[model samples]
Target chain A: MVNREFTVENDPRILFGKRLAKIRKELGWTQEGLAIESGIARSYLSGIERGKRNIALINIYKLAQTLKIPVKELVDI
Target chain B: MVNREFTVENDPRILFGKRLAKIRKELGWTQEGLAIESGIARSYLSGIERGKRNIALINIYKLAQTLKIPVKELVDI
Candidate 1:
């Protein structure tokens, strides 16, 4: 039997997700709304915010632009 | 007994660490050299490159300046 890893607990991806969620909430935007503004798929946005995926670099800038935040804020260094 | 987390495998902090290490190596900088140039501690520079610490935002900018790279390149996001 093989044990597979499936959780994102304490992942740095969670940091990005948390930042994304926080910015979206601050803007009074839903996941779908942010997706539309970012020109990314809603499902992908949801996955990103849930820390289910390691988002690409380009997407990070797009999301930051849509959220009206600096890229550094989202990255948190 | 408490199970303290002791690993940073797949941590996004590792991403920053890796980028820092890469940049430093490209410039042929030793950890001590980078610390001297960035005005940070050598031990701290080692720790940051090892992904053993979550660096502060200001320090990130300092490291970027020392490396002569854009902050976005270090972020990869």
Candidate 2:
């Protein structure tokens, strides 16, 4: 048995995912809506929310811009 | 020319690089010192400080941890 999926709850990626989900939900945004508005692929956005993507800085910036928040707010964790 | 390198002065990667350099320099740490301490490659760290890399979240967190600062401080730019 191989444990290829190494994501843990305390992982930064996981924490980032959870944070993103909470903020998006608070904004009443569906994953689909955010993807469309942020010009990210829906599947990619889903992956990001699931902590499966090692997202880049530019993408993070784009997401923050789309949500009208500071990059600091999105990544403060 | 294809202009493959699209980096500009105002690019987030550039801003991130400048911010990282400023913080690291203020700490009186050399790039090689920070890279070794943070477990990042010196060359890669150099690129990051030059705004040539679109750094990932985990790496950003690692750099901040090495600097004893909040992740937000490294990324608030």
Candidate 3:
């Protein structure tokens, strides 16, 4: 069943979100700070953190740049 | 100026595209092979390689999986 198959670890989106949140917190930046620096909306960033949204390649570059890391680091799970 | 600034090396999309192409060729895989393996459209993969279209997070995951690499390796440029 669909419900049975849904899991945080099994879903790549959720895994990516968790990694993003962890890295952001590790860097001591708030969601607002990241949003402002990346020029992405705070709501969208929030959604991304919560695994509710998917971001594009440009955003991957922006987030990595804002976070001062490579895109690979940002996408690494 | 924006026109002067958009060099191949300076553009993250183009850099990423070049890297993708190199990695694909290193693995002896064609664009069509990647598309069919990843369930992504061949045209879209072509666009990504040409830096004409931006792909989302899920697509990144799919591409990495199809290419048999870590997401970080796939995105690294």
Which DockQ values do the candidates obtain, in the order shown? Answer: 0.08, 0.86, 0.73
lDDT of 3 by residue, B34-60 (tens): 999898899988988987666777888
Question: Which regions of candidate 3 fall more than 4 Å away from where they truly are?
Answer: A1-7, B1-7
Q: Candidates' lDDT values, in order?
A: 0.70, 0.86, 0.82
How many angstroms is residue B62 displaced in model 3 relative to the true structure, after the best TM-score fit? Answer: 0.6
Fraction of real interface contacts that model 3 preserves: 0.86
Could you give candidate 1's per-residue lDDT for residues A5-54 as a string of tens digits?
Answer: 22345355565678779878988999988899888999988988877666
Per-residue accuracy of model 2 over B1-77 as CA lDDT, tens digit each: 22243447547888899999999999899999999999899999999998878899889988998999988888978
Give the clashing residue pairs of candidate 1, or none: none
lDDT of 3 at B14: 79
lDDT of 2 by residue, A1-77 (tens): 22243348556777788889999999999999999999899999888888878788988988998899989899977
**TM-scores for the candidates:** 0.50, 0.89, 0.89
Better of 1 and 3 by DockQ: 3
Residue A44, candidate 2: how far off, in angstroms?
1.0
What are the per-residue Cα lDDT tens digits for candidate 3 across A19-62?
89999999999999999988899999998988877677788788
Give the CA lDDT, 0 to 100, for residue A18 in model 2.
85
Model no. 1, DockQ: 0.08
